[model samples]
Target: MQIKVSTKYLKTSSKKMQPIVSLIKGKKVEEAINQLKFLPKKGGRFLLKSLESGVANARHNFNLPSQDLIVKEVLIGEGPMLKRWTPKALGSATPFRKRTSHLTIILETKPGIEIKKEIVKKEKVEELPIVEEVKKETKVVKEEKLKKPEEPEISKRVFDVRRVASGRHKQNLDRLRRKEKGGIIGRIFRRKAGDK
Candidate 1:
């Protein structure tokens, strides 16, 4: 199986990224990643990200093993350049282009190896017994519920003053609570905000 992953409009020139590709091309996925890890160039980071993405695609989407995969091709194409002017002497501006690159890495499995997809055999389910058991469980649950009456859940609006407030007031209250909790210091010190 062949898996391709492309990262477009990377903020680096194709000329800068081209040399790094030769080091990884025709190499194993793990070796390529290791080689890229020690590289000092900015292009190496970009290439590493693309290569890892390709490997992940091969493993997750195609169910191919990383040990069996090889980097088949690395295509680096020039992307759109951002034109900017730098202030020069005598009130003149020099126009410069910020070059970008589009990197595409193709990974394929090794030769003479056949990929065997796992076949999941479904067992025929007996429904009559299952239905009877479910009915009996429901009856027991209903009897238990009847013995102990459940308390009513309190509405948030009844207790939380913020919920009762509308629009700008609610937003202000939320902002105040957020500020009181931590503010900028909390935001800066917290590790991985996405985890919450």
Candidate 2:
């Protein structure tokens, strides 16, 4: 696997792009390209273009099919640094660096084959199994939640059962009982004797 990159983009230094390339090297070409395309950095665009160009170069130079090859390694290194000076206050100068990058991308055919693997799309991955897995998880959670039994609600009466005979109603009932008594001791203590 051989790859080449040209140093032309002039803005940010190559030091920034090298680290990012290392992280995705040896990854699937489709995945690497997808990630590079979606990234928001200025250097990402340049690196992506270089990677594509490298792949194209490999296919044409090596007589290999583009689809049969995957990016095996990607490398970016600091190139010759351009020096300049920035104006400072009071007749002073500040040193500035104009950075360049050297990018290398390597592609290889699928192991033991002269063709590249068809890039499996993320969206085409089966979804039915995932939905089923989610449903199973939710069912387990619901069962766990129902494991504890709840107590039934009981309506409590407001009456104080112990103090029923302490008020005016209790006194009236007591008077009626006394008035109805006709035994010897009861008659002696009856209200009819004018003991009211």
Candidate 3:
């Protein structure tokens, strides 16, 4: 069985991904993953994610072992270009494209291998007893809740009104203190050299 996985619109150019893809094509899944883990390129990370996704799909969905899987194909294609402009000297703008790439990896088991799917059989469940237990538990919970007293609801507006009233009173007191210290002209004339 062949498993294919794709990553779309990676923020890199196809040219940047070419070397990484070429290095892993036709290699075993384990070898490709190891090489990708140590590669020092940004594109390597993107390709590695695609390869791992393909390998995981094969192992989990098809019950194929990673050791038996090989990288059959690696494809990198150009994606949409993000157009941007930079300021130029002569009141003109220099336009550029931020390139993107799409990567796809195909993994297949080695030749002479056949996939066998395992079937799981579910046993019959006794649901009537479970339903009766849930009903009894719910009744006990309702009785416990009925025995508790309800809490009184506090009004948030009362606290908010008090806070606002205290703030205004403080502001008025500050204004009166400034007036008692005489007007701005009196305060400035009487001010010490070190005082504002």
Considering lDDT, where higher is better, how would the candidates rank from best to worst? Answer: 3, 1, 2
TM-score, candidate 3, is 0.67
- Candidate 3 residues lying further than 4 Å off, grouped into runs, are 128-196
Candidate 3, 19-101: lDDT as tens digits: 88889999999999999999999999888888888877888888998999999998889999999999999899999999998
Q: In angstroms, what RMSD does candidate 1 have relative to the true structure?
A: 15.0
In model 2, the Cα lDDT at residue 149 comes to: 81
| Model 1, CA-based lDDT | 0.86
Ranking by TM-score: 3, 1, 2
**Per-residue lDDT tens digits of candidate 1, residues 78-182?**
999999999999999999999999999998899987877777799998775457888899999999988966789976555555555454366566677888878
Return the TM-score for each candidate structure: 0.61, 0.49, 0.67
Which has the higher lDDT value, candidate number 1 or candidate number 3? 3
Relative to the true structure, candidate 1 reaches a TM of 0.61
Q: Which scores higher on lDDT, 2 or 3?
A: 3
Q: How many clashes in each structure? A: 0, 3, 0
lDDT score, residue 43, model 3?
A: 94
Flag clash pairs in model 1: none
Model 2 residue 32 CA deviation in Å: 1.3
Compared with the true structure, the alpha-carbon lDDT of candidate 2 equals 0.70
Tens-digit lDDT track of model 2 for 90-142: 99999988888676666666677643435656775565545788889999999
